[model samples]
Target: MVVLVLTACPAGLRGHLTRWLLEVSPGVFVGQISARVRDLMWARVLELSKDGRAIMVFHADTEQGLAFRVHRHDWQVVDVDGLSLMLRPHEVGGQSELRPGWSSVARARRARRRK
Candidate 1:
């Protein structure tokens, strides 16, 4: 099985994907396809996406039973201890900062003790 998520891509790209994959939701596509076809589709996405971003997740025989491919996305895939993981960037400028939702709601009580 393959899952593809696209963001900010052209409408034609999404329409093109629907031929082989089901558009379960807007910008989200899923289907079972051969590796050759999947690769071709990914190439097509990269060609047509322009300034957009896309992520593809597919079943594999690895430790995680899945693999990922990302294009023009801030989050990245990394290998750690023979495992694949998504690395979330810590800093926030154009992107939102990574913070615990609970503590982010308001100033943490612990901050008062720092002074």
Candidate 2:
């Protein structure tokens, strides 16, 4: 199995980037993504550099798994394979530190809203 870390500048871009990644690679991918939709915007801004372009990063492999760093600016691909091992969630200590920033409070609020 392979693990990846996906991040976006703003919450809106995160969704688009996630969708793009899912559209590109279907079943081989699994992760969490969060973004806000205003019901008007449909695309994401993937800035590779300071030049303003969308960038996506992931890890891929056939037997040993591969790491990829993509620069959406000029469409550059850098492969870093056999560099490191993918860390499992359980191995990372526990769920105590899982909540970052305001996520925990936000989750509680969302739960209340749902109820």
Candidate 3:
């Protein structure tokens, strides 16, 4: 199985993809094709996608049974402990200033509970 997601790409590139894959939704394509064909399509996408971004996920023999490739995307793919992960782009600092589950309301509730 193969999944191709495109963002801000040209119509020509999308049209070229539709020839081999099914457009499950706007900018999302899914299909199963030979590796050679998939590579060829990816090449065409790179040639025609211009400044657009694309990500392709496909079956593989890896531990997760899948692999992915990204082009001109902010997010990055990383490998850790033999697992593939998506790494979000961080701010200028090494960590993000904003933290999850630390909303003001939550903080107020915590303060009341401590009292």
Model 3 compared with the native: what TM-score? 0.81
- Which lDDT value does model 1 have at 108? 56
TM-score, candidate number 1: 0.83
The alpha-carbon deviation from the true structure for residue 88 of candidate 1, after best TM-score superposition, in angstroms, is: 0.6
Please give, for residues 1-115, the per-residue lDDT of candidate 2 as tens digits.
Answer: 1222333344444445465334334212343343233111223343422343433333344344444433333334433464544332342444553554467787888788888
Q: What digit string (tens of lDDT, one per residue) describes model 3 on residues 1-115? A: 9999999999988998999999999999999999999999989988999999999999999999999899999889999998888888775366675674579887887788889
Local distance difference test, candidate 1: 0.93
- lDDT, each prediction: 0.93, 0.38, 0.91
Clashing pairs in 2: 46-53, 46-54, 47-53, 47-54, 60-66, 61-65
Model 1 weakest 10-residue run by lDDT? 98-107
Better of 1 and 3 by lDDT: 1
Tens-place lDDT per residue, model 1, 51-100, is 99999999999999999999999899999997889998887686557454
What is the lDDT ranking, best to worst?
1, 3, 2
